[model samples]
Target: MTVWDRPEPPARPVPLDRERIVAAAIALADEGGLEAVSLRKVAARLNAGPMRLYGYISAKQELFDLMTDEVYAEILPEERPCEWREALRVLAHRTRRAALRHEWLADLLGGRPSLGPNGLAVTEAKLAALHGLADIDTVLRAVETVSSYATGAIRREIASRRAERATGLSERDWQRASGAHVTRMLATGRFPALASAVHDGADVDAETTFATGLEWVLDAVAARLTRPPA
Candidate 1:
């Protein structure tokens, strides 16, 4: 065929790269949870053959790692706080917010080591926040403690949200009226403390509950810290 009759080489397939591949995978996961993401589906979204993705990612786990790191980028603050307490608090809150935005994140938050650039940057920020306050071991422990709390809390919050959506009721309402059996059990004198808390406790929103618990943990960390002399 003549040059004029050629099909223009199909536009170079839009220049596939790791970023585009990860973005497509993340979008798929966001829409349908982590189960929805696969190399074939990601390839289909990018209009490329499945084998073409192998150049950028060897397996699905690597794709997940990339997606997690990308979310970490979102978790990183534009301006981190200088004080250790506020800085740790910001990391926890921002991470929770990011998980809320990407519900699938709850599944993978602490599932694996985050060795990507953005993920390492987040770790660095947390460590830097407590740099001079204590020894390296103490600082590492503090960071781990805060991170563990944030991860567990985020997962629980997301699970609660999903339960709420599934049951068409708020968590408080669900707890209050789970069933006749639960009501009867609560009424029994055998579990007075549990019953009292169920009946008398304030039904706070999820944010309030998470914040209160986080502050309590931070307070515990503060108690353990060996603050340098002023």
Candidate 2:
């Protein structure tokens, strides 16, 4: 056919799937935090019309679920730790690491039931580690409690890091600036306990702090396991 008579080649559309949609959302989140992600933006990133994403995910919430599950896949270690304490400890640390990698995770951590397959698998691993080691009630409580600590701790860590990045100062430096005002408050002598803590507390490593707190929580759980019933 002559060049003028030739039909234009069919336009190639970007492939659309849940994984690609979720990846686009994650890239947006990683670049600008969770608040930056949107269905329209994600669709644009994949070079598809916004309505195209509705086929894979119905709402923004579903997209959040997918993002969370992606993080869960990263949190689950290939080699499961054998002992219950070690397994739980490793699970908590891995989760914290995942939050570090994907700061948006801290916002959604334990905020809702993780119904995704990988999320369910993560829950199963935690329960399996404690199965037969404790009563069902204790096992459930143990899993929930450990998750609570990890989630709360991770949120705090991410907040601190974001603040550090914004201000270009570690928490200690931020505190020192606040300490100036605190020192003035101390002179008023109305806040003795706050004064003592502020003056006496040492700023320690975050990893060490998180590890120590997890061990303390685990120790408490162990006590419950061994304690005699009334």
Candidate 3:
């Protein structure tokens, strides 16, 4: 005897595309932070299943790479600025803003294996910024120095932000927290430079500190480039 009727298959609409998935992931990150972003969450946001997302992105790392590139691509290189110094300043500030928007960015960029278009684009842009330098070796060194400083500075800034948010305190609170330790160290009279530096308000305005350090880095690069052949 034949079956009375065959059940009809469910109609499968066009599933979420990569761009849509990535967009949802970024929004999730913005709302709840990177920790809140997961394949399942992204899929849930799109009304799909976690396994469906895996088809478009092989792993969580890929998702992270895309998210990072999404953030990185927002920074625009300066166009014919007065000097490389100004260009570098703009690029540095732009990158700092990107990192601030997504605090986990520094940790991702610093240690992750290169994984996507945006990541490569950022590296390529930085390399291109040093294009006119005299030597490839020098250019490479400059890139290393600038990139290292950017990553480390961004990471520290993220930490400081998180600390402030969690403790409901500002840099002033940080100074207060360390006051005892600092005072005791000063009282010992063994570390003159450290004591004097702290007493003089060494860690003051963050913007000024960032710019000063970046300028110092640029100066060091220029010094190396102009040094006599050895």
Candidate 4:
């Protein structure tokens, strides 16, 4: 076939862009966690030279930032709720869902400022939820508090799941956390609170635990907003 008759190499795969690069990286992260994602791997996934991605993403952190912004898209509700409480609740739950979908997200959540468009939008929605309901400082604190809780909760949940998978035992097992070490610690009777928690505490669902903690944090915020200014 002549040069003109050839397929033009399928238009060079539509020229890699930031969106495509982030997508490829996210796919790799989804399969094997953040540690598995690298510029070389993403380039291979896209069938392009590794240098090609550099034109769009200067560094690996930028790629991770982009991936995080993409996740913020999931955190924004389709139709925002009217009440501030509901709005905050929706945002928290959505963030948790996003983490579950991309478990590696737990590593980056709240790790750095998200300056991308989507990340800015998520922050806007969070602050807007209480636009006129409270003072700016209070609102900022509330949003930060919720975000911190979500970040920690998701990280802990992922760690728990990983530990469970590494060991054959379910989280309900008596020795899930440290196996024989924890069992032995409990046996010593040196720490009553720790022993009681390990023995008497009911096994609660992760989602329930997260929601319960979030509600408590929100309650504190609510009190701050409603109370007369000191």
Q: Best by TM-score, which number?
A: 2
What lDDT does model 4 reach? Answer: 0.84
At residue 38, give the lDDT of candidate 2. Answer: 95
Cα deviation of 134 in candidate 3 (Å)?
A: 1.8
Worst window of 10 by summed lDDT in candidate 3: 1-10
42-126 in candidate 1: lDDT tens per residue? 9999999998887677779888888989999998999989888999999899999999999999999776668888888999999
Task: Order candidates by TM-score, high to low.
Answer: 2, 1, 4, 3
Kindly give the number of clashing pairs for every candidate.
0, 0, 0, 0
Report the candidate with higher lDDT, 3 versus 4: 4
Please give the range of 10 consecutive residues that has the lowest summed lDDT in model 4: 1-10
Q: Please list the C-alpha lDDT of all candidates, in the order they appear.
A: 0.86, 0.86, 0.75, 0.84
lDDT (tens digit, per residue) of candidate 2 on 50-132: 97776667778888988988889998999998999999999999999988989999989877778887888899999999999
List TM-score per model, in order.
Answer: 0.89, 0.90, 0.84, 0.88
lDDT by residue (tens digit), candidate 4, 1-230: 22112232223554876668889999999999999999999999988999877666667887888898888898888899989999999999988999899989988887677887788888999999999987899899989998898889999998888777787678768355567897887788898898888789987899999999999989988988899978
List, residue by residue over 42-73, the lDDT tens digit for candidate 3. 98889987877766777787788778777777
Q: In model 4, where do residues sit more than 4 Å from their true spots? A: 1-14, 173-184
Q: What's the distance in Å from true for residue 100, model 1? A: 0.3
